[model samples]
Structures are given as C-alpha cells and as structure tokens.
Target: MVYIDKEKLKEIYPPNFRLDGDIQKGYINEDGTIEGVFTLDGFEPCTLDGMEGLWNEEKRLFIPNEVAEQGAKSLVGAPILAPTPKIENIREFFEKRYSMLDCYFENDESVYNLSTDEDVLKKYEDSKTSFVFLSIDMVKSTELSLKLPLELNSIFDNLFLNEIASIIRGMGGYVYKSVGDELIAFFEPANLLNKVDDSILCSDYIRVFILDYLNKFLEKNNLPQVGFRTSINYGEVYVKNVGDKLELNGYNLSATIKLQNFAKDNEIILGSNVVNIANKKWKSRMKKLKVNPRKLKKEGLHEGMKVYRLHNLEGRYD
Candidate 1:
C-alpha cells in the first residue's frame, strides 16, 4: 500500500503547484491498501506509494477514507475498491513493467464500469472543466463484425475495448463513455501538465501493448491483429447533468473526435493546444501531421489548426 507524502511535495513545489497524477491507478481498501504512483518534477515524477485516503476508482480521485467507508457500508458489504474492476493480471502487468504507475485492480467485470455512479457525476454536475480529452476506436471492428460470428465479434470487442479502458483508468483518466469498440475518455483538470504528459504516456503504452503483448496473443491464437486510432485535445467543457447523466459539450471534444477520425490505425494524434502546452521535451518529440488543407476542416478547431504525432518511439524517455 502507498500514500502521498504531501509535506515532501510541498517543500519541493511552490504553494500554487498541485499534482494528482495517479500511476498505479490502484485503490486502497478497508481491509488492505493498493499501490499507486503520482508524479512531481521533470521526468522525475514523485512515485506515489499510495494516497493518504481511499483511491476512488469510479470518481478517479482520492477521497477521505471515512467517507469511503460510509459509501462502502451503504453498499452492504461492497468495499469501495474504486469500483473500477481491478483485474489481477492487469495489476501484475503494471507492477512488473511500469514502476511509475499505481493500479488497484483485482477483480473482473470492473473494466466496463465507469463514470455513471452518483459520486463521480456529482462533482462535475453543472460545471465547466478544462481537461485533456482522448478519443479512440478499434480499426478492425467493422471488418471483424462483418466476417465473424456475432458472439465471436462481441468477445473480441469486449477484449479489445476492456483492455484499452483498463489502461485509461490505470493512467488516471476517466472512461465515461464507450460505444461498441470506441471509447471517449479524459484526464482530470486539477493538474494539466501531468495530465497532458499522462495522455501521451497513455497513448504510447497502448501502442506498446498492441505491438508487444496483444499481437503476441493474437499470433498464438491464430487470430488477426488489431489496433486503435487515438486523438487527444485539451479545453474547457461544460458538464451539464440532465436526468442524472453527464452531457459534455464543447469544441475540444468535437475536435478530438474529428482528429481521431483523421488518424491512421495504430496511430496517436494530438491537437494543437495539447502540442502548445505540452512539456518542452515532449514538444521536441512531436512532429506535425501533414495533410491536404482542404481535407482538414476548420470547424471546432483552433486557427492554424495542426495535428501532431510522436516522432520518437525508439525508446522510453528519461
């Protein structure tokens, strides 16, 4: 189990600085605690051994352990282990491969669970937030659905969609909406720098998973490989609650969707705003996507709108 040592953080960072980057993306339970990692300065992000309180997976934010217990008791024996469906293998993968990540999954069926809970929806109710939005969809879903049995297709969809959703949740992003093989997720607004960094990191991790693990699994099973197209953007969006649901309306979201549509399979794209505000080192790693000016639409896009892709994937960065 790990928690944040805020005093150490306060000393290193200024009074105005805040970081809530969740790497382990795990949760602390009533019986025990899960590990997590939070970032801090430069490439030297402070590793979060854990949070001081309960790591609410549904809310994707830390909450008081007392309140967590109350909510857990209210659920009649269901300990609020972030309710993000912590799968054991997923947890093991992070523990072995990425030391900077905090993941708390140890259960199944939690992959598809997301922001529908009251606790999550309440915070964003009738509010405007500046967040990093990421959109992705499987490239081969349509073709697979056409050629394969519905049952087999559904299984494949679930496998691919749930894996990506798990990564989003683990990276401290929220998966509020997933349709078929497509997903729309966002990083929290409290700390945009780490969030943007996390967004790019999340995309790279997904790509690596496709290139390494998923592809191997598909090959072993004699199944075709698949990949996703990802696009990320940043801006303020209004979260309006209607009939106990969240409706996010904004140009950022729309443009992110458009950017995803323009991405090639297995590609990760970033909007201009994200490129402009990203850490300087990361900015150096990205290159603008070339396209016919007439093909790219201006609606819901920034002036001199440009899309970007990571030019360096030769190795993990320091």
Candidate 2:
C-alpha cells in the first residue's frame, strides 16, 4: 500500500521503458499507462501477456519488470520497504518508530535497523573494509595517570588525544574508537601510496611526533618529560553502526593489543606482517638512513618478526 512517488521512480529505475505505476499487477504498461488491478508490494519481472505476479517470497519485496530492468543496469537489485502504516509527519513517525524499537537517533542521522540479519552483515562487512587498528598509549599511562592533578590530567588527555586524532586524520586515517589512553584508527588502502608503506610511515611519524611533542610540552609546562609506545597491524575490519554508535572490528584490534603488550619503552612495535613488508620494501632505504635493521632470531622470535632499532648517526642506539 506504500506507493512510491512518481518522480522518485526515475531515480530508482534503469534505462528502459518509463514505468509509472505497479507493473506487477498489470497496472502500468510500457508506455506509462495504468491498467488492471494496481495492487503490488513493489515490482518484479512478468512473462505473462499483460502483467504477472513476480513476488520474491524470500525477500518479502516485489520487483516489477520495469523496476527489475532498472535494477539490472544499476546493480541495485530491488527496492524493498517494510509493510507498515504510513505516518503523515516524517519527524514524528521516525521518532515514534525508533522509540518503539528501543533505538535512539543520533545527530548523524544514520538509521540502524536491528531486525534484519542482512543489515547486520552488511555493517560488519563495511567496517572490515574501512578501518585500520592501532593501539597507542603513553609508555606508562597508568603511572602518569596517577602523577598529575585531576585538572592537569584532564588537560593532558584533551590536548594529547585531540592532537593525536588530528594527526591520524591528517594522514588520511580515521580514529574510530578510543579506550582511555588507547586509540584505534582505520587507514584506507586507497588513500595511502601502499597499505604497508603508509602504515609504517604513519606509525613511525606518530611515535616520534608524540615523543617530541611531549618533550616540548614538558619544557613549556615545567613538567617531567613523557614518552609513548605504539603498535599497528593491518587486516580487514568490520565497521558497525548501532544506531548512533560506531565500532571497528578486525585483526587491528587483537594485533594492536598484542603489539601494545609487547611494546617496550621508547619504541613502536609493528605486526610481523607489517615488518615483513617494510623489510622487503624499505630495507635499503633504512640502511641508507642509518637505521640499524636487525632480524629477530627465527628460533627466538616468531617467523616474520623484524625489529628496527632507532640509532644515532654514529650507529649507536639513542
């Protein structure tokens, strides 16, 4: 009973006959004429002489021949709407509907339908493609968390977190979620020159940037110098939206946590995969830049583990 607007039909339709009414019920003809009983859930293909019922019982969505043709060209498949009483006021309708579903609307206006399994799967798939997972925190955030006054702590968190988030965004990465002092970011492979290269570059840049920034902050505020450590990994992650809330899923989460656990003071640890790619691509450049590249012992270290020790110009660890 939910009739689509005639104008909107063009937007949804593919190149073919201009359909104006329900093609499944034999109402609208190829030339945009309405005939027969114009009752249809949506649209479908019909091999019958005039009109035919081409309902998709599995999807609970109708697809008329005209709409189906459009779908074929546009790759939209079909347009399905849930059967319900149409409310007059759009805002009131949505508010009441979401309330009835125990969902809250956000400023972002992203609608999350909790009833559909496909919706959930699509959400998970989208997240997997768009996120990079990294775990970043001060070398000893627990110790530092207790050292400063409540006000100073708040200031530090705000300043440093905002700066770090901005830096991630500047590097074409998205900070999807943060836990206290730790953050997870997603870097689009398309945005980077190469996924592995960009990941390493960003990781190294952030590590050094945070350290240098903190040193300056300490000097300016007359506080003790603070340092940080980080770990990064790459993998497909699902980004999910629960109403207004968003989350990321992938190896980035587990890899980041593992990296953080293995992170030593004043250093950044990258996943074995990242290290392998970096060693192959940037090994020569690393040597030219005077970076001491050492392969972690295969027997002692897991396969694919490569460690780079930052050193001074004299080849001494700083």
Q: Pick the candidate with the highest TM-score.
A: 1
How high is the lDDT of residue 283 in model 1? Answer: 75
Candidate 2 deviant stretches above 4 angstroms: 1-131, 191-193, 279-281, 284-318
lDDT of 2: 0.46
Model 1's alpha-carbon lDDT is 0.63
Listed in order, each prediction's TM-score against the native is 0.64, 0.49
Candidate 1 structure, TM-score to reference? 0.64
Cα lDDT for residue 207, candidate 2: 56
lDDT string for model 1 (149-229, tens) is 877676677667667766777777878687778888888766556678778877777777766776666677677788889
Error of 2 at 174 (Å): 1.1
lDDT (tens digit, per residue) of candidate 2 on 1-318: 222334555555442322222223333344444444333333344444354435545444444445434322321222211111122343453233323221111222232211222333454544446334556776566776689887666555544554555455545456665667666665655422244454555565565555555455456657656666776666566667667555555544665565555556766566544443342334333321121223223123433444343223121223
